[model samples]
Target: MSEASSSLAYRLRSLRRLETFACLAAVIVLLLLPFVLPDFYVYFAALVLVTGLFATSLNLVLGYGGMYQFHHAVFYGAGAYAFALMLTKAHAPLWLACLCAPLVSAVLGFLIGAICVRLSKLYFGMLQLSLGSLVWAIVYRWYSFTGGDNGINEIPLPNAISSTTGAYYLTAVVVVVCLFLMYRIVNSPFGKIFQAIRDNPQRSEAIGVNIRLHQLKGEVIAAFFAGIAGVLYVVVEGTVVPDMLFWTVSLEVMVMCLLGGWYTFLGPLLGAAVIVGLRTFTGAYTEHWSLILGIILMALILWLPEGVLGLIVKPANSKMELSAETGRK
Candidate 1:
């Protein structure tokens, strides 16, 4: 190999070592968090994990696939509602409810993606927002079914996972598995095509790749994981509200992505923690927490364009690295 290639390889290896160490440390800390912290903070950490997963799922399409998923949180809401309804209305078993919930989100994703992939850029995003708004409206008004604006509360959770610690552990496991799978997908050959299409759709098409099919696949995968996060939300919060599907929720997730670093694989996760932390801690002090959040986001956009994590882990500029680096891969 050339000297430059050798240097790059060495840098990658060192980065991988650092990432592995950090991950191990993080896992250890999370595992012990419940025992050390109060119940409320434990629940809060669980929220961070699920929210991080949601944002990461969005990053798969928005950051890597270069798709505009303006109303992505609809899939999240869909998953929550599906899980809740299955358990409450259908009287389904826990396993069945969990299994079917993400599928519902996936199907919704496929349907919306089928149409949205036909367009690009702002039009695609707007169409998704419109469709999402329609779903939100339905859920918001369906008092008989979805409990309308009041939402479905008193959700029955299994005894094993009903407690804060148990729920936190469950959320931790699910989130970790999902993150691993997503990380694998992002590094796979399929993810390479996603980046190629993102960086240059015309050239990718000219190279005999089916662009629309791949984009649709990306949508379904992202939605499926977002759905998983939603299920976790129901577990953590025990309520399925219309706000879950609202456009503003989607925007909040997008902000998490930008704040964490869309160009890095784990950036959204970090962003989610920061956002959730700010909301939980700052909101406790004053009602004007949004002003602080807005200022932080503005600062991130102007100064830390690559995101907070981006400072430590520089984004892979090459399309071959899937347009983003996990710093682990």
Candidate 2:
């Protein structure tokens, strides 16, 4: 190996060690957070996890698969409605309601992606936007079922995890497990195929890759996770609203992914946390919060164009490392 390659390898090893240590420390803190934090803060953190998971689901498609859809949050809303309806109307068990949420979104994804997959880029996004709007209109108009503008309310949690503290811990554990599974999926062979298709669809197809089928599965996978996020969101908020299914909500998630650097596995999560925290806190202090948020994002774009985690993981930036060494010396 060349000297540069050796140095790169060493940098990667050191980065991995740092990441592992940080992760362990974070896990320890999270485990003890409920005991130390106020009840409201714990509940708020649970919602933040849900939001982060939702953004990560968007990243699975827009970042890794190189697909853009303006209506990705349709699955999230569908999952939210599914969970809410299953609990309130069907009277299903908590576990069963959770299982059905993702399944419902997967079905929607499969059906919608069947047509959208044949189209390229902007057309795919527009079609999804149209379909998502159609669903939203239906949900809004169907007052008998969806509660229309008022939305479904007063959702009761299961006996096991009904408390505020119980729900927050459950959100943490579920999101962690789901994210780990997603990390494994993204690094696996199937993920490689998705990346290959994203990088070069024509070449991937020429090499005997089933482009449409792979894309379909990717959409379904993304939708399934979005569904999980939505269901958790409903449980956290105790209600399901039509606004949650809007295309604008999906745009917010997309922005979060971009803010955090979609190329990094944990970028979406970090971006979600930052955005959610900022919106929650800033809204309380100022009426010009949206303007302030725009300024902050602009700064992030200029300084950390690759997203927040990109600051740590850019192993090939030898000049920056050298500059840091010179400063230290």
Candidate 3:
């Protein structure tokens, strides 16, 4: 390789190492935050972590897999409902409930992904949306089981982590672990294949790749994470409701991903922080919190189309075009 290319490669490797260290340092700082911050802030931070996890799962499909599954809330809500039912109806322990919740959502994801994999991109998204709506409708109508619009209340937290501050620390640990797992997955060979499929499914298939299987695998993995986020949400909020399964919930996850800059691993976490911070601050001052949020989202979409992180990274100049032209000459 040329000296310039070698230097560029070295710089990229150095940057990746720096990023990994920075992420670890950030997680350590966050774990220590509960000691200094107020109770409310700790709770807020926990909520942000949960929201970030949910958005990151969405990114697994939309960002990496290039499949827009609009019904991601199905898995999230399914997880929450699973936890609630297990705890309330079956009288299961907190650990067991949490474990079973993600398993249930993973199964649901596998089933949905299996069926949806046969359809084209747009149709698959639409079908997922329809299925999500169906789940929401059932949750809403079934008052006897789900408590209808009122939601299930007083969900127990893990015994070892009883206080909100303790819960915040626990959640931070989980979020860090999840983010690390996601980072590993994205840097793995499987991730390369997923990105290849995203760039050109036909080309990947021609190369002997099973596009459907890869897509389905990605979807199931995404759902598993989303399910874990849902369990965390129930723990933090101490409730689970039908509205958690609604289309709006799914849209919020998408918005978080877009706002964070879908291309970067940390983008969803930053996006979730922004959203949660805005909501908490804005809702305190005015009754029109939704209007303010809508305006903010519109401004971000219009002005920062690539999201906040994209603005920081900046686009690389296209030397490939010049190289191709020179070769032709």
How much lDDT does each candidate structure score? 0.93, 0.87, 0.86
- Off by more than 4 A, model 2: 1-21, 294-305, 315-329
Candidate 3: list runs displaced more than 4 Å. Answer: 2-6, 316-329
In the order shown, the candidates' Cα RMSDs to the true structure are: 3.7, 4.5, 2.9
lDDT for each residue of candidate 2 in 147-264, tens digit (9 for 90 to 100): 9988999888865576778878788888988898898889899999999989999999999999889889999999999999998898778889999988778878877887888877
TM-score of each: 0.93, 0.89, 0.92
lDDT of 1 by residue, 139-159 (tens): 999999999999999888987
Q: Give the TM-score of candidate 1.
A: 0.93
In the range 18-129, model 3's lDDT, one tens digit per residue, is 9879878997799789889899999999999999999998899898899988989889989989998899989997779989999999999998999899986899999988
Error of 1 at 270 (Å): 0.8
